[model samples]
Target: MEDKEFDKLTPEEKKARFQKAVDDYNSGFVEVDYTFRSVASIRVEEAMEDAGRVSEEFKPAQIKVIYEAAKADLNLEHYMNPKFSASHMKFIMEQEMAGKDVTWLPIGKILHRSIVDKPLTRDQIRRIKERMQRAEPKDSVIADLHEKKKEAARVPKKQGQQKKKGER
Candidate 1:
């Protein structure tokens, strides 16, 4: 689209246009210059920790909106390296930060199988969500310990196991 054509669009229309560009990028229509990341560039993830921090003024929902807006701004600045807005990206980041196995998330499957491609399937996503909900934020060592405690309780008591057994 020409500058004059884009200029005529209202703010909302312009946003929609940019969003389409992002969608196009995500669908692999618009190729991203991976080299740009190697160059001095601001990473969205670097700011995520601070962004996700819930201040009295800013909440998680508010941060997400801000992050999405920033993504649009980044796309405007770096058209060749547009940011792909995946709903799972933030979730993955948070989960990974808490040391959870994000492999379960069907991020391999993209969201919308549009005129372009969707990496993930809805069925896969549903399955992943179910697993996540059932696990209740499964952590690494934490999960192991929790399971061990439950199993220990089930085992038949043999000769009274003391709390802190250390012979003098």
Candidate 2:
């Protein structure tokens, strides 16, 4: 409210803390989402729980499997930043999802893109199912490297080392 309007409040109204707060809120002066109570609200809670459900949606064990895939692909490595929550990372997984865009949406708006209040569409389900299925078997890249070394050892080395200049 403008200073003039605030000043016009009766001395008793100004002195009454809770009522003043309510009046500001009804006047659209207060931001409700930042309040502690918002954490338990449906949208906030969904955004919180969404961090896990997306990965667990397709396969129970695929979280680790997808991490392994990210370890192998340099292109996706940047988005694996420890600073971002898991749900934020999922939004950037594919080139189309968010690319470099960051969302300012409140949880209610974000839930539309996520599988919370509303169920995922058929195509969304199919695509996520296929993507998870395509990841390499969990923890296999290091094993593949080990196998490469084993295969190299199985081949014979040269019979003699290269001769140095007239030493013998």
Candidate 3:
């Protein structure tokens, strides 16, 4: 199917197709292996714990400064390195001191909210709102799928049990 044609399907139909594909793949009709590399799991856990201490009053400007410094500290290229720098380390410590919710959220989301909350020219606001409206359908579909998945996960399945006809 062409991409545009696929995009025209009702949300439920798209989900049903996705679920069937996953079920088939899981049953070994398709062979797939995925590998991912990331920072050590223990370190990631420790960082998350440290980030949790940042206060709600934390400033984005301060966070940006720390982020820049962190990029410098690990001798990472501006775009490729991940370790925190001395400045970032200090910011994290300050956040911890302030007793704030410093749990890290994806930077793009943080930036998006910051931008939308600020005063904007009428034209800018209109453009942003239009873009957001265009994006809403996809977001709604994703949310619906998440709810469905959660419902499915919560349902208990009996051992050695066969799914009833039409269950899938």
Candidate 4:
């Protein structure tokens, strides 16, 4: 309603309108926005604990939203070579400080796939990248193993699969 029209109403009519709005809100007819909260309002430690306790069956989207909000509110940045988010690191730190199990959180595992403390050294990454970029045939060891299997398969299976004499 326009302010002018509302101002024209009697006090009793205004009260009735306010009551109807409240009723609509209470009845789920209105979506009351609760997203105004800031990350500063969150207790990081508590959020970590709660996240740790999240059920394994919870959807990834749910976890993502929760974590995304936490990350945004804190204005956290990614860290380390693998680019782990600050929110993830904070949660792990909180769990560690409390002596809680830090390894098995479903959300944590989803958010940080590697979950490694020490990131791979630059040399290691460089070597891996170089190896991947190489034009040589890959999997030499597996290639030999597969060749051996093919050779074995090519040989006919003798009756009873008897071992040759003196072949220990």
Writing each residue's lDDT as its tens digit, candidate 3 over 116-160 gives: 122335465456445544444555777868866887899997688
Per-prediction tally of clashes? 4, 0, 4, 0
lDDT of each: 0.46, 0.44, 0.44, 0.47
lDDT (10s digit) by residue, model 1, range 40-134: 12334444444453223444554454455345433211111113224433433444445544444333234321111233344544666655555
TM-score of each: 0.24, 0.18, 0.18, 0.22
C-alpha displacement of 4 in model 1, angstroms? 47
Best by TM-score: 1
Those runs of model 3 whose alpha carbons end farther than 4 Å from true positions after fitting are 31-168
Root-mean-square deviation of candidate 2: 16.6
TM-score: the better of candidates 1 and 2: 1
Q: After TM-score superposition, what is the CA distance of residue 110 in candidate 3 from its true location, in Å?
A: 62
Q: Rank order by lDDT, top first?
A: 4, 1, 2, 3
In candidate 4, the residue pairs with backbone N, CA or C atoms under 3 Å apart (3 or more residues apart, or in different chains) clash, namely none
Off by over 4 Å in 4: 31-168
List RMSD in Å for every model shown: 17.4, 16.6, 27.5, 15.9
Model 4 scores a C-alpha lDDT of: 0.47
How accurate locally is residue 97 in candidate 1, as Cα lDDT from 0 to 100? 49
The ten-residue window of minimal lDDT in model 4 covers 75-84
Reference-based TM-score, model 3: 0.18
